[model samples]
Target chain A: MTAKATAPTPAPSHRGDAEWLSMRERGTVLGIRAAYWLAIAVGRSAMRPLVALVAMWYALFDRKVVRASRAWLLRVHGRPAGFWQVYRHLRTFAQVTLDKVYLLTDHTRALRFTRTGHELLAAQFASGQGAILLGAHLGSYEAMRAGGETTDLPIEILGYFANSRMINSLLARLSPRAAAKVIHLGDDPIGVMTRVQDSLAAGRFIATMGDRTGLTDRIVRAPFFGQEASFPAGPFLLASVLRCPVYLVLGLYRAPDCYDLHCERFAERIELPRQDRAARLQQWVRRYAERVEHHARSAPDNWFNFFDFWAAPPAAPPSPPPP
Target chain B: MSQTDATLEDQLKRLIVDTLALEDVAPESIDTNAPLFGEGLGLDSIDALEIALAIHARFGVRTVANDEKNREYYHSIKSLADFVRARQGEAQASAAPA
Candidate 1:
């Protein structure tokens, strides 16, 4: 047999595609706007079939999403993923996205939440100091926000929202109060830092994603799912600078209507001294990756990063070696 | 500028240079009025955090997180010196007896 015939099919090269930031937000504004209004008008029970239809459309037509989903599923399951599995993955994402409408609108009476390690957060609040809640893209952060509202805990989301302008704008319209809670990462560095600091100092938790690396963010490589992937060092660096406690919080979707909000302390404080800064950063990132892996393995379908997460990062000039 | 303010600015310039590890850029080379971020020294977010930490550790004067004036205060070396001096004055006043 020819060498080519004997070889496994090479995965399509996504190197040409810029990072997730550059990926177009997929659906048309009008379509998403229409969907949002429809969900609000008809309510979730009536919207389930339509959501499934839309998810099915994406699962069938979006080749990139399908490939990414299959890749993640294979790693999680240790077997080839079936077409139905991919469809269900897309459907789950669609359901969660749709739920954001109700969550943002304070219509969370229909949804259920089970919280664990809440006492840890309570103890942190008892200290009269703010802490950082590091979350991932695995599940519904909105659910956690809703839970916080009921308990009178203020949470500010620090995120880069340039990519999802349409969705963000629509969601903001859903609840101006909820919109105010978002601290968009933008041009004003001092403003962003000060806002985060102020919130933390006031004993309000600041929630941010630990996974996605921004365009100019410093990143560290960590072994994830038996492969090396880049995780942003920004969160950890910010934690060290702010001199605040860091906690891992994930709001996992347990299908149908329940969200399990899990919170655990990641660090009392992240200290990266000048003597061993890189190594310390690497250790924190590795532990972060391990925690993310542990959770992702348990809730395999909750993984929402619909991109080639393991693809080689864009090259950058190497830093000068440590003295 | 007052002699103390000038000295404070110079001290801040050295702190920025050393804290960020600007290899070729000398402390004195940093202009007092030149912006510290975005097009001036060409620093990013991480650099800002480093400078914040260094200032906190070295001067023991913490930058107030919610102060609306932080943007202006961090604009340049001169402004940072002003901020530090003002905060120092406030701390001293708060400590003094009525």
Candidate 2:
């Protein structure tokens, strides 16, 4: 056989494309979302069949792409779910579009819930010292609206919201609930971080993702699920740099309108004791990775990292040493 | 400065080992003239940037973007040695008790 070439994978030249999957050319998805929001605005159940028909058509005619996509998810991620199961998940992805539109239109009713973690949240809020709520994409985290409404402190979600301007504007209009507490940390991160710090200083309760890599330069490599992955050191770095406490909290979906509010101590206070800020930040990343792995492993079906976690080549044999 | 240069390769090896936490890498085994980007060490762009930052903090060397000097400087232990020698010369000249 001819010798194979070792070249870097063909990727977008922009560093931001390396950051994460781009939403720029996602006009089809945007169009679907726009149609949903328009239906919601018309205040008629008239478009109900139209929306279901679109979902049905995708499930029926989009067989090739969905099969390949499902196969990849199964092959790469051990998704034991069958073709129909994967189709259901994709079908529900459209349902989430409805959620986004509903959130913008009727934020309170959509995000409304009965609180359970009262004493725990209250003490955290009462402390006047900000706490980090480590949440993942398990449940309708918008239920956090009820969480904030119950507590004395402001429960602000520090997340990288949708980049699509049209979708975001729709989300703001369609879901008044999400618009109230949702703060978008778009491309310019340090500026958004200044706001996060200000919120924390005001003794507000903060919730941010501890799973995926963040939008900043700071990163820490750690082992996750028997493979190496890079975790964002920004949150931990901020905790260390800002001398704050970090809590591991997750809102996992149980059923319709019900969720399990899980909480555990990842690392309480990450203030730099004697070492440099970077070292302390590394410590926080280590704990965060362990917690993320533990939680994801606990619910592998719920592990949401669809992209390659390790980013290593598939089926490559270890080569012999170079001369 | 030769004393520092004597241990320079060892320092760089230590830097990579420490920054990446690679299980199999040893300082003495890293080829002096091997390519760090591709076949030699099999390092990626992220690793290059990661090791670059750590090396800068430790050795006072700044890695510029899209720079060709890196290909030459990162060629082998000998190339890094020569570059460090020039930097050390400048540092010494600037610090000659002026």
How displaced is residue A65 in candidate 1, in Å? Answer: 1.0
lDDT of 2 by residue, A1-323 (tens): 00000111333544332333333224323554555546566542454455455555655665543554464356436755565665554434444334434433443343334445545666776788777776654343444443444333466666555544544554455544443354555532433454565667778767777665544334566766566666665566556545567777754433233334556666667665433655766666777777766655544334434345555322233553552
DockQ, candidate no. 1: 0.25
* lDDT value, candidate 2, whole model: 0.54
The deviation in Å at residue B15 for candidate 1 is: 1.4
Candidate 1 lDDT for residue A161: 55
TM-scores for the candidates: 0.80, 0.54
For candidate 1, give the lDDT of residue A156.
77
Report lDDT per candidate. Answer: 0.76, 0.54
Q: How far is candidate 2 from the true structure (C-alpha RMSD, Å)?
A: 11.2
The digit string of per-residue lDDT tens for model 1 on B1-98 reads: 23455488888988898887777888888888988776588777767767876888887777655457777889899999898888889888998968
